[model samples]
Target chain A: MQKVFEKPQALSDTPFAYCPGCLHSVVHRMIAEVIDELGVLDRTIGICPVGCSVFMYEYMECDMIEAAHGRAPAVATGVKRMLPDSVVFTYQGDGDLASIGTAEIVHAAARGEKISVIFINNGTYGMTGGQMAPTTLIGQKSSTCPGGRDAAAAGYPIRVCEMLATLDGPSYITRVAPVDPVGLTKTKMAIKKAFRNQVDGKGFSLVEVLSNCPTQWKMTPVESLSWIDENVVPYFQPGVFADR
Target chain B: MTTKKILMKGNEAVVRGAIAAGCRGFFGYPITPQNEVPEYMSVLMPQAGGVFLQAESEVAAINMVYGAASTGARVMTSSSSPGISLKQEGISYIAACELPAVIVNVQRGGPGLGNIAPGQADYFQAVKGGGHGDYKLLTLAPWSVSECFYLTALAFDLADRYRNPAMVLSDAIVGQMIEPVELPDKIEVNIPPKPWATTGRKGRGKNVINSLWISPDQMEEVNRRLQAKYTLAMEREVRYQELAVEDADLVLVAYGSVARICRTAVDLARSERLSVGLFRPIGLFPFPTLPIQWLAECGKRFLVVEMSHGQMVEDVRLAVNGRAEVIFYGRSGGVVPTPTEILDRIRKTYGRSAGVSHYRLNPGPEARR
Candidate 1:
């Protein structure tokens, strides 16, 4: 029997840690697939931030460093600067990137660091009990914002791709979702392009993945996928914001 | 570049030592007292084929060190008092992950952004595990320019030896002061390969350097191993210098820049036919507790001198266990006592001229209480 699909060579055989319906698994697999395709699996270093994907180091076969919350960009910068020939990337969540670690991410981008960033925008803090995040949609209910995200109190959602597009430092900036087959294919392309940018010695490149948090969203797997398309997509509007 | 004997400031010596010790990366922010360190490294590191980055802030600087250190590189970061406080969390994470790196704290006065002048107020912070964790960092206190060069080199060695962060705790006086130093020959240090470092996956399995262990048993095991390492360090790494302490009835206990001043005070007191001795600690974390314990058993009174309001004295008091009286005299808020002022305080406490009475010194009655 011919096998139609097999695990990417850049992924370990260990079981994934994300929730059943969470899109973290999809994105993680996509990143590993990209590394394998680039034939740079052995020389790729990944900086995993504190979030639901905190254990990303365990799932990937590449060298990994677990960074403190929001500090993954700075860590990635350090590693890339020290080992210029090696490919380095950071995997961060919206809470980790846009909230607590805004300074590090902004400065890392401004420095035009030669690295890639895999940002996951799940619109909520999935690991920390579904708390309202910086990218949390207005009128969305979370553990902290039980009354739903009121713009008067919580402000508007942050569009990381668009915001980073304004900076001349980054060479490529895009947003993609993994809710469906078509979206997943687009996300894989974006991830591959971002990795290619780093391999080509281009400046910073980032691919923001608008993932879903089925467990945190208190919805079924099917409902969560629809939620991303219905509400999250309209606000986040996945697309290539910039390609320098 | 550190070829032969030359005159340089303590801050300059730190950079020279780091270069000689095989540091390939230096990340730091601009802060007072230690500003010269980064200023010097910025020019020198590039010349030596190393990386020198002035980070956005002290916090970011330490995080940068964390990134570089994860690759098992010989990296370092320098800062002052308030800046060091900003680095505590990052330092704790690095230690918890068992990464090898060196951090230099050229301390200035502080509770908050105190002053640029030299101060030893961070004695507790340096030795007492300033970060929140069950871990220990090897700390070195250099009192002179020569020691500054030697200890910084040793700090890099010790950090690799223990697979932990090592701190070179200095002060403004030593950091800014210029003195002659016989720079040692190019010392070749052997860095054992850390297979656990997150360098690339080439010829090895996946390496994950992390501190978080969600499981209780796993976290407990990690903490237990760290505590054991600290105990082993205390047994083998406790360092101090004892001067005429065997027969003296009074001993002046000090470390870092203040120890240099204490030496002058001891010399002048000895000239006055007073039985004054000096006990200086070189490694502050694996503190010289045993030496003080032995001296206290011999019925020797102690005068704990520092630039802070008696922080190290608490450690001394614990070691003494009431075997002898442990009195303290310090000057904080960026003020350093001269040799004469220190001598007066010594005289007030153990003055043979006044028949060893319970008299007080200047800063006088308020400090006495």
Candidate 2:
């Protein structure tokens, strides 16, 4: 008998420390699978941001550089520029990429850096106990926005895939989700395409994964997945923002 | 078989030096005093088959350097005072990651965006850890256009040698002034393969990662190892050039462009029969203290003249260890002291007063000297 599901060879044997039912584990699996499929496991360097996936270095059996909060893009830019032949990718959360690291990511894409970015937009700061993130939808409640996010006060959610797609440098930009089996499968395809873009020497590819934060959303794992399907997916509709 | 000598500004020399050294990537924003650096690279880098990017902001430029350096490519960035401050976070990250790259700071007057004039006010910032954390940058202070070219090449070599960041600390005057420079031969530079680089993990078992994280114990060990490397660097990399110190009564210590001014003052003081000498530090970090102490033991009075208000003077005093009177003459806030002004001070201090006698006569030089 053959196993239908197993950890990717690129991933270490260490069990993930993510909350049970958190979609981060699923996203991580997809990325690891893509790395294995692309055969870029050895020459790939991943930059982990200061968010939920900060410990990504330990989980991914790749050369990893842990960047300061929101600095994964800048660090990834450095890694990619220095090692042009090496495949570089940054694993960042919504807060890390859209808020504090906005300048880094924008300019990196604008410069058309030959790298890939796996942006995890979970709508809250997961590792820091679920503060409101830049992609937090209107009326969403987090520890920071206890009374639900006020668009007039906190501003609307940032559609990073669309925003970044405006830059001419990036060759590919897409937004995908992992709320259900079908969405998860689509998200995996997007991740694979991002890796393939880098392999083909296409400059700057990104796959923004709209994932569920079960603990932070104050819902059961099933409800969190349902919430993503009902709320997050509609606001940040899944599709390729750019492909050229 | 010899390299040709050409007249060029110090900023231009740095650009040529980088190109000749096989530097393939440059990221910078326009700032006074050193704008010529990027401007020259803009034309030359492309001609030399390199990348030249005029970034939107200093923050973006430094991050671009961070990106290029991460690739293990010979990359560089330049900025002025306030711009350098804006790049501190990236600088710290680059140091933490142990990336090899060159950073040029054509220092102008500052505690803020002070002025676009020549100043050595960034001495402490450059030599004593400009960014946070336990790390030191290999800093070189070039006094002339030739040194600018030579030191920029040295900066790349040193950065690659130690797998560390190196800085070329210039002043507005040095960056702006035109002087004849003998360009170095276009020797082939072998950029070491970064087996540890994060290109990808294709055949090499797993992907490579450049991170600053480890467990508490592991972090401590990493820091300890870094400290040991810095210590070794200090022992081997201390560099300075001394002039006419044998049997001298007064030794003037200075660096960068100010050192050139002090040299002229020393020449004039000798003509006036004051017997003054000069000690110029080339490598600002791992400062040339032993030679300074040796000069002090010869019973020569030391005067530290700088464009800043007595920053490097403190370093001189520390190196002298009270063996000789370490006097200071400085003009801050973008004021460039003339050679005549420094000569006048040297004459007033050393010519009129007889060293140890003056110390006994005047209890505090800050009050009376």
Candidate 3:
């Protein structure tokens, strides 16, 4: 019998504690699938950040190091240098990667560190209560910004893919979302490509995933996907910003 | 190759010692007094086929060290007062994760962005664990240029032995001073494999190195394990040098460069027929407390001389445990106490009428005649 699909061997048997409608689980599955496809699960090491997916190590069947908030890239940089032949990657959120860790991410990218970066941009701080993150939209409401994110006060959202694309260090930079089934397929392809680039000795590959936070967004799981397709896809303009 | 003596500065010797100790990674930022450390590493690391990175900031540098050490690599970082303060966060994180690494703090006067000159003010920061949390660094204080070379290597050993951060606490005086060091042509450092290191699981099970203990009971257990290791260190790692303490009635307790100055004062006091000796502590954290307590029980009075405003004096007093009188004399804000001034203070401790300090006891260049 041809088994069309099964759980990825790279994913551990531990169940995820993520909230309902959270796309982090999907992203995690995609990463696990990518690792299995590459048959490099044993040779891969992961750096987890201080975010909703901080416990990503609990689900990944590989060597993992939990980095201090916003420090996954720097930690990954260290691991990659120490074990150059091993595949190194970082799992980070918008708050961890775009806000507090801006310097680490920017410099790691600029240094052309040979590591893969999986950046989850959900527009709001998830681990801590929903706060206005650097990617929060102008009219988006968060716990910290009661009156919705004011462009005049909070400034505009950061387009990390476009911003990081300017740096010549990174060989591959793309923006993807899994708001729907078709989008999920695209996001998986982007994540797999990023991993393959590292295996091929390509320096600094990042895939910014526009994830959904249904609970924080005060929307149904179904509505969240619809919101992402209408609002996020327009603002973020998902596609590869750089590749070579 | 045979070991031979070579003239070198304390800062340069520290790099040489690290190289000889089989260090493979160095991430550091530039700060005064310790700039030579990074500058030397920049040239030495590449030559030695190691990694040397001048990180963007001290915080970044320490984090990089944390990263490298997580992979079971022998890595280090060196900085001064202000820079070390910035590294406190990463230091705390590393301690929590139980990663082994060496951190060198070349002492400089500070409260803010203080001057680059030497100071003994960092004694409390080094020994008492400058960073936040229930952690302690196996702090080693070096008094001479040669010790600056040797102790840096010892620091790496202590770090890996207990899987905790080891600090080599030096001052600007020792870091800048030039002296002869015995160098070995090649060193074969034998260490056990880091079973916890995340160097790709391969055939082995996945390794997850972390310090985020969310549960109360689990956190307590983690802390208990750390305390047990610290207890083991205290029992075996306390190192100090006692000079002429068998018959001496007065003992001067000091560390780092201050101990060297106190040694000179001890000689001057002895020349003046005063009974003064020196107790130089090498391990500042596991602090030779029992020896000082023994001296206190022997009815020996202590005078703690420091370049800070009575920082280590409290520790000496606590160790003395009210057995004898413990007095403190210090000069803060980068001011170094002369041997004559220290001798004067010693004479005053014995209830003798001593001449004024700062007045040259010898009519030499500092006579101001």
As for lDDT, the candidate ahead, 1 or 2, is 1
| lDDT per residue (tens digit) for residues B1-369 in model 2 | 357767899999899888888888998999898999999999999898888877767777777677677666789998888888888777777777788889999999877879898888988888888888888889999999988888998889888878788999998999999987777567567677776554555566553334455477877776787788788888999989989888578888999988999999989878766678899999988788888888888888888999888888878888889898888999988999888899888867844474556334533323433
The residue-by-residue lDDT of candidate 2 on A1-244, one tens digit each, is 9889877987899899999998888888888899889987777888888887888888998777777777777666666655667788888899989999898899888988888898988899988888989999999999999999999999999999889988899999998877778888888898899889889989899999888888888889999888888999899999998899
Q: How close to the true structure is residue A44 of candidate 3, measured as C-alpha lDDT?
A: 95
Report lDDT (CA) for all predictions: 0.89, 0.83, 0.89
Which residue pairs in candidate 3 collide?
A: none
Those runs of model 1 whose alpha carbons end farther than 4 Å from true positions after fitting are B1-5, B351-369
| Model 2: per-residue Cα lDDT at residue B216 | 79
Q: For model 2, state the Cα shift of residue A204 in Å.
A: 3.0
True contacts kept of each: 0.76, 0.71, 0.77
Please provide, for model 1 over B1-369, each residue's C-alpha lDDT reduced to its tens digit, 9 standing for 90 to 100.
445667899999999889989999999999889998999999999998999998888888999999999888899999999999999999999989988999999999877878888888888788888889877789999999888888998999999988889999999988999997888657787878878877798998888889999999999998888788888899999999998787677899999888888999999877765678999989988988888999999889999999989899998998998999888999998998888888888767653334434332223322333
Q: TM-score for every candidate vs. truth?
A: 0.95, 0.92, 0.96
lDDT of 1 by residue, A19-117 (tens): 898888888999999999999998899999999999998899999999999999888888988999899999999999999998898888888899999
lDDT tens digits by residue: candidate 3, B24-135 = 8999988998999999999999899889888878878888898899999999999999999989989988988889999999999877888988888887888887888889
RMSD to true structure for each model, in Å: 3.2, 3.4, 3.5
Off-target runs (Cα >4 Å) in candidate 3 are B1-3, B352-369
Error of 3 at B212 (Å): 1.2
